[model samples]
Target: MKKVVKFGGSSLANAEQFKKVGNIIRSEEDRRYVIPSAPGRRFSSDTKVTDMLYDCYHQAESGKDFSGTLSNIRERYDEIIRGLDLDLNLDDEFRTIAENFKNKAGIDYAASRGEYLNGRVMAAYLGYEFVDAAEVVAFDENGNFDDRRTDKIMGAKLDSIERAVIPGFYGAKPDGSIKTFSRGGSDITGSLVAKAVHADLYENWTDVSGFLMADPRIINDPVTISTITYREMRELSYMGATVLHEDAVFPLRKEGIPINVRNTNKPEDPGTMVVESTCNKPKFTITGIGGKKGFASITIEKAMMNAEVGFGRKVLEVFEDSGMTFEHTPSGIDTFSVFVNQHEFEPHEQQIIAGLHRNVHPDMIELESDLALIAVVGRGMRRTRGTAGRIFSALAHAHVNVKMIDQGSSELNIIIGVENRDFETAIKAIYDIFVVSQL
Candidate 1:
């Protein structure tokens, strides 16, 4: 039962957090492979090591002295080492990094040092082999991640090692230059490693115990999602739920490796399980609620619009020509509405209106701005009746008006459009009806 366990930055923030992570790992023999992110904030006011590294790198590039910043980074590692009672010294590592910084080794290389150094400390503390991500994770010369290449090499390398720690978030390009993934990329790294090893499960440890039914900022102490399928997760993630990096699921999707979004601090709590498909019914009719704000809808009306050939294409082409991608398009026999980012559409509104008049020649054009889209996603929703009615009932009771409603044929999710002012209230209402009321 091979398992790849990846710890987030907060899980290894300081000595205490590191000790907790160490105990979690040592408690499970199946956790044979490990991944570590950079040191995060120890407290709310504390700056992350990665941010400090970026600042130091910028200073060096601008021809300013960076000794103090580099020293502070070195101290963070020293503090962890001291707290862990390890005999390891990172003086040489610091010196090499300083020299590279002086040479302007690029921001990617500098930012990657946090994870690199933390992996070093974690390996020494756990007595496991340290595998540098640059040696395993692969990227192309263009700095794009090379998944197939990563899989081929990582699979061959990890096959022989019984236990090892690989730093997350960064890798090397074909020319051997450092390239880091975007922020929150450690999740992607963990996903890739799990796929390469074909592990039974990929455990992602973060500060949260599991995925919440709604954003906590909107709903107070939202119910935790016990189980969610890949499709439902993608739908919620696309709408703005951020418990996990949205792209992290791709690598494991084909390999059928389920990911466990666990909490480092609350190890006993059974966190959310994300699977490809599940027969296990969810506790609530809706598995999750997620949404986004700042949208504008362009509504066009013409008699017998559905009977017109190439009408939909013509409408979308106008948006495509303006370089504005529409988020959703709800239509009827005589009318159509295209949703796009308000900021993107505001400038091109006049031009798009003119173009639409010239192309489709609709009777009237109407525009509404400051819209928000909320997605109530769940696989069990397919079997449940009146899901949309309940959502409407809940929102109506909260005095939140729904401007638009769209649902895919799969019946897995319902997309509701509301005013920006009602975004939070809409989410709370949906959560209350589906989860809170059930409890």
Candidate 2:
């Protein structure tokens, strides 16, 4: 029945939200551990506490008077402490943070203080023990997460305390330098804790209730995915779904721990349950669909290319030498195509083209800009037939030309390439084909 709950910045933005979190924590005895992010934007126009800390560090680095900015951050925590009516004296911690700022703590260290300070306030409000992440979360010499060491340390620490609040985001390196996860990385911390404790559920409390079938702005009132597999999540996330941190998936997936994506504002509604596998049927034609535009494809055609050995390897070596990664390589007997981000290839386009000519010796090389990739991912697609046929029919009906198509062996996803201008029309056509026609 144990659960490791993590809250995003939006969930811990203000004193009222803090109170809501306290109630949620107090209601469940097994919700023994908590992880929090820096205070997020209080309103649309305001800057987040994390952003403010970064600004303060930049000012301090530039030898500017940043005391006012630093104090505002301290007051945000102080106001939360006062509103909670806690007797905790945070002067020492505040002084410690201020001294670090004066001495020029790295940007990661400065940014992490928001979560550290907030963890203290939250612990006092809930009457739980405060466990600083820096002490327990370990990083190696290279700054990669030391999962083995972290699991051992965190598990032993939690076993000693009944309830605790652990700040998220940054951990300490071997030399005590602060190293942070990418933004929205608190989810990864929560997942690591869940795996260490073997919790029954890992709850990610954020602003949204659950994941929608498609981008809301594009498809109006799209259906929500009630249950999704880890594989399905990866596909959708790769296609630009933003519900859960992709890096956070593997830790829990390895231990078979299910993650519940829920809303702090609407706790009563059962949010999406991300599990290993489920027999529950989807309410929509596809689980989710999303895409990113602005990609460029390199088309290389060579007669009798299949007759040559190591041709593909030689071509790919050029990309590696240029420090570029290929997204997809769809090939025919005599032709091969490499797709990559347009922005990434823009700088090295001429070099890449020249390298290809020198190494692979293609008959013709052409570059197509303003390309977009759309992914239609679902487990239901595996059970149903003619999925590809239906997709092509829909696109043809809408007059949206398909540039390239790649379907993984898992059959969980099918990515279609289209022109950037035709991106919206393509998605609408496919969604209507599978979703609207069924209705």
Candidate 3:
């Protein structure tokens, strides 16, 4: 069973953290492919190498003296090499980086240096060959990841090498210009590598042992989810559970490759296993509770709305034309409401209101802002009776009024909209009803 192991920035923040990662990788022979992110914070007050690189790049861009910032970044890496006792000197690499920064390489190039530099350190420490991501990963002119081309190249490249360490996050465009995925995109790079190599498992080593049932900030020491299906994970991720990169699951989802979200500091823990499908029953009725704030709702009531053809379409077209996207559109025979990001909808509210009048010509329109949507998602929910009842009961007990509730047809998730002030209270109440009670 081959495994593609990707370590987060925190996992390789310093020489000591590097030692821990080296042991974890060497512990298993199946772990032939290693992906490393740039050094992260060693302490709470420390700045990450990625952030430092960004600052350094900005200084160069503004034609300011960047030598001091660049020197500080060098010291970070040099400290790690010294701690590892590696016979390596990166003076030449720094020189090259200095030249590139002076040449005004784009932000993507600047952002990627963290991963690139770390990969070099990791390779030296592990005595493995360092494979540059730019040579294997591909992006198009539009800067979107070229999946097919990347898989073909990355797969073929790894097949020949017995073991290799590839840097995460940034890839080269067809023209060979550096392009990066969004922040926390190292997760995407790991998924892509797992897909390319057709590894049986992708082990993402980070600070957390696994995904939690609720946000720890709201619920203290929440239960760690042992197993979560891809669909369940995606729902939770979309609703704001960010244990893993939401988009990273796409490539592995198609290949049916499972991901193991293991904690770097605690390697003995199995962490969470993310699969396409699983036979294991969920320990709780709800797999996870995830939600977000800053939403608004638009309700339009037109008599006999269900009888009118394309009424919903006309209403939605207004939002689309105005460059706005609606989250949920719960409807009734005479009315339907469109939920959208309040921040995105505010500037265009007047235009949308006028468009609704001209297009659908509703009898009445109601607008409400400061809403939050919480999703209680689980595959086990399909088999459980009165899951929604239990949720509302918990919320009602907490004196949180529900503004809107929508249960997906698959019974995989129930989305509850509440006043923004009640968001945390509602989640705690639901957690108590489902997870806390069971425990």
Q: lDDT: which candidate is best?
A: 3
Q: Give candidate 1 misplaced runs (Cα > 4 Å).
A: none
lDDT (Cα) of model 3: 0.94
Single out the weakest 10-residue window by summed lDDT for candidate 3: 181-190
Q: lDDT score, residue 39, model 3?
A: 95
- Give all candidates' CA lDDT scores: 0.93, 0.89, 0.94
TM-score for each of the candidates = 0.97, 0.97, 0.99
lDDT of 2 by residue, 1-439 (tens): 9999999998899888898887877788889889988889888997899999999999988888888998898887777777777887888987887788889988989888888888888888888899988988899989899999999998888887877899988789989988888888888889988988888999999988888778887897877778999988888888888888999999999999999998888888688899999889887657888899989999899999999999999999999999999989999999999999999999999999999999998999999999999999998888888989999999999999999999889888899999999999999898888887777
Stretches of model 3 off by over 4 angstroms after superposition:
none
Candidate number with greatest TM-score: 3
lDDT of 2 at 54: 94
RMSD of each: 1.3, 1.4, 0.8
Clashing pairs for model 3 are none
